[model samples]
Target: MKNVKLISLALSMLICFVVSAQERTITGTISDKSGQALPGVNVQIQKTKKSATTDFDGKYNIQAQKGDVILITFIGYQNQTKTIGDENIINVVLQEDNQSLQEVVVTTAMASKKRKATKSSTQMVQGKVAGVAISSGYVQYAPSQSIVVRDVVSLSPKNEPLYILDGVPVKSDQFAKINPNDIQDVKVLKDKDATSTYGSKASNGVVVIDTKNGIYKNLTEKELDAKLNIVHPAPTPNQEDYDAFVENAFESPKTAPLSTFSIDVDNASYTNIRRFINNGQAVPKDAVRVEEMVNFFKYNYPQPKDQHPFSINTELSDSPWNTKNQILRIGLQGKNIATENLPASNMVFLIDVSGSMEDDNKLPLLIQSMKILVNELRAKDNVAIVVYAGAAGLVLPPTSGDEKETINDALESLQAGGSTAGGAGIELAYKIAAENFIKDGNNRVILATDGDFNVGSSSNSDMEKLIEQKRKTGVFLTCLGYGMGNYKDSKMETLADKGNGNYAYIDNIQEANRFLGKEFKGSMFAIAKDVKIQIEFNPKQVQAYRLIGYENRKLRPEDFKNDAIDAGELGSNHTVTALYEIIPAGVESDYLNQQPDALKYTKVQETANNYNDELATIKFRYKKPDGDKSIEMVNVIPNKTVALNKASDDFKFSTAVAWFGLKLRDSKLISNKSTTDILKLAKQGLSRDSEGYKAEFIRLVESAKNVL
Candidate 1:
């Protein structure tokens, strides 16, 4: 009996040892050999029932007994098993299940892309992706019936898919401004099944935007084939005080300065004055307005093409309203780094004394963070301040220009919570600058608030029109934006653009310093205004080309010469990048049209003889607001066909952004583009992010994979 008990106990002890020895965690990635994510890939302890399917990202968090046998199985990819590994992150690549690995109808960020899709989602959705819409600022007051998926971001609260630009959850809760040109592509992941990766965060769905990496930031330009235009002129304009009209007139700068407006004697056929007087059209051709038509062109400044390695093409033309108002703009470009004159001097302060500006992003940081810029101000500069909340007034007006003290005091007293009339505060500031306007000064009006113009004349349209009128007074504008929860980025951008100003977000202290101190040139000072570029195809030189992202900025060919047509301004060191995807005609695919005239229809045939020349010829025009004459430039791209697949990293990176943008909008125009192709190309094209943007891209891609 004693011997039997000992043997039984020994067996029990052995069983315990065996169970203890099975304690181990096996981890690995589950993907198909072709590099496709395999969701529902079951991972478990071989003998136990413990298992978990891969999350949308093909990622699983699981634990098993040591040295335990693990099983991984997916519906299509071949099953995989590995012993317990010590590594923290385990990635698995699964092989196709042959009979099971059918085609996939992967919905990538709301856009459907085929992935060997055995499912019916092939050929993408018939018309437009689901749940997308276009919110055009040009037509905000106009009710739109269009569905989702527009290239431009909508300011309205609803239907804006969550943005994970470069992985930073997109700080655009309110008035988050993103440069369409800066974005790579926006993947709209709208479906619950597709966006479930983020749980509640993705409940609103997600859009993954990959932005332009400072391409080739690490390498010197190899070919340097890009041609750019360099601009130079007088002192920079004051964008903030864009409205200080000598509210009193003093004549000194120009002798016998003519009134800004004149009757169109050349265009008007009537030489008799009395006949025209009845129409209110001949009021007083002598009403001389400011030369800077509206807020857009009141000032002229120099651009740095010499300090940088970029080239420029300049264009000159007569203003459509009055040939006396010559129009000039320069295109400064480069393959990389865009060696151009960048901004370096700037001082902006936010006086957050308002009830509406109290939110975290809106006014608190807006007030506390002037230290970022205050600390970086140079001895060559001066700072000014004007504050208004309950009343239109100035707390500090252009101090002997102690920038440090001026910025600090302005930041110290700023607070939110009361009716604010932004218009009144801004007006008081210019009154002070008129006395302090620097002869060649970079005079500016830096308004920091929630943009609530409630106190007096605060309507967005009213503010824009007023600021537009103010710019003629010759003080430019710069807006330092803060506060969220009802931030009006659309309104602010309008005010800034019309004021010949630049706008930036103070998401954090780092961004504050970057804009106010570090990147001073690119943020302040205008090098050119109303820049317009027109490419006239030698119908013989090329068959078809696409303007990638500036869909909203497209100008009527005739407007290219009309000085009145407003265009985006370029700051020193600022780069305006654009891309065109082209397809040469006669390559077998019919790019032209052949619709016969049926019932009221028309048919036209134009031969591809125009495709005979090289690539395309580019035309550009600009005017020095002060100089009576306009300056112009042009460049012709040779028809030499560079391999599309072998485009430069810059070209490739830009190309990827465009492809994704099209996908986000569900544009069927760009043929044969796929989610996988974008990923494949971007894998090798990613550039380092000194600004943390690159890291955000990787995370966005990983998030995008779950949806696709």
Candidate 2:
């Protein structure tokens, strides 16, 4: 009996030891004393190889046994240590290290070293440090002798720092071709320091090289290639896809007198075009949607004095590109509802976590964008998260918006992998949204993706059908596009258009702030849906008219009155603008190339109407957020025309934007207007620039000039 008891006791103790030795995930957030989250901070299990780095939100998770000591370290911050216990969460606030702040800290994959920020100090310690190798000579694939850094474990296949020659990103092979003698300065950033700035492209590291006089500055990729004689492989091609569209042609009042189309609130094309220009690349002609470019900026319009959801304004001026032609501007401003008065929201974040979204710009930037949106959420709002990879799944159930930490934790835990099953994810998200439907409230599914849907039901038509069917459930969609290469813009645009939603491309955090932060109500709450615009050009006053941009949004004249036909949705506080180039009656131009012959069989009757001074009759049809029937409004544009130089700032700015788009598209209709002309016109309209968006437009125009 004694011997049996001893064996039983020993086994019980062994079992207890095994339970204590098991590892569990330790997750926590690290912030500075001022409560700012510190990203790229290193957290490691002391005496063990297990470690993790805090993400953009300063959240980290690592596996370790209870009682293991974990050390947290970040440059310019005092190191911290904590012992793991029963609690799985351990939040830390680090204090600044004054001494460390004064010195330059060089971090490598293996460890970090600090030294005085003396001139050429980093160069002197380059090769002396372990895991860092610097060599000067003709390296592999390089034509000239250049300083190359090696020895660190590469996160990329090539395992070298991403080289930024001047301000443009270049491949290592191209970096090597530059003459070392012309080099001005070289700066290297490693680990989080590098990735934080450049995203996933700099996961291995980044080396920014500035040449004397910036010989390669502001050069487009094609220009750089030509200058350097860089031969690229023929098999590689840019995978980004955009729907091809033809520019709208001039229509004769004698034949097609009615100009009809849906109003588009989407601004994706403008930002996407801006991305190309900012990156020093030739803007793709097909990617330029003049309507989106004009509508991207908010215009000054009077508020509605009546019960209408939006107010309409009209202006007439001479066309900037062609002084002989006239420009007509129609503007609609949605009523701005205060955040407190806006209806409660039931939002499902339908995120794509596929392998294609693993890029730093796609996923990481997306997460940061969501965090900004979360900050805008009110206590009454609720959020759910559904992610799609190889398949669709809900990572977080419907949680109150007040529980921001929980929602953010869910966002932070997401990892990009597997093939895209966007269709399945959309179904699941709509189902969740329907189940948690807020009647008369804002119930929506916000999809953030690179739009690279490759799995089941991945085609553009497939997505359009899926979204069209799902939208009947009263659950709207908001498509937020991300990333560059392989980006499927057509798919995103189709989903948004079919689902009664708006689409915006988020290229950086600032854009996210603009769409989801500062303009939260306008981006999230719909005041009107199925908004259509139709104009009856006065045959007595106008001979020919052309609708600028919005080529794909054109609707049949009968479709405007058809309540069943779908159109664009106008969000609260949103503005929509449209321009028309008009040819006055009896005025002949090259655009009105071939006039239709007079009718042979029928006698045309001309009725004398009292509105001889009218340029056009504008009709607007829209449905309330929850209404089935459409409401119609009509406004008349008078025959008065203002000089382009005397037009309102908004009119001048919008015309300038339209002119820029025409220039970029190389539209034959536009008379030969140089970039200098566009710049001058843009500066004239650069008033009421509170957000600096107009100023940014001016800068983009300058950039376009330099690159084009």
Which one wins on lDDT?
2
78-107: candidate 1 lDDT, tens digit per residue: 677766655645687876433422332325
Q: Candidate 2 residues 1-708, lDDT tens each?
A: 999999999999999889767988898889988898776688999998677767556778789988899999975468999999899999999975433122334555566666653545654555443333333421123234343344445343335566787757886657767775655555566776776666555665667666667788758777888787898877457799989998998887778878999999999999999999998889989889999999889888987789999999999999888877899999999999888999999999999999888766898789889988898888999999999999999999999999998998798778777899988999999999999999999999999999999889988888888988998899889999999989888898899999999999998777887799778888899999999999998888888899999998999999999998999999999999999998888886887776657888753567767478988899999999989899999988889988888999999999999999999999999986689899898899988764567888888999887777
lDDT at 322, model 1: 20
For model 2, the superposed segments whose C-alpha errors exceed 4 Å read 1-235, 600-604
Tell how far residue 209 is off in model 1, in angstroms: 37
Predicted structure with the largest TM-score when compared to the true one: 2
Candidate 1 segments whose C-alpha is farther than 4 A from its true place: 1-331, 334-352, 400-403, 587-611, 623-629, 666-676, 704-708
lDDT on C-alpha atoms for all candidate structures: 0.46, 0.84
> Candidate 2, 296: how far from true, in Å?
1.0
- TM values, all candidates: 0.49, 0.74
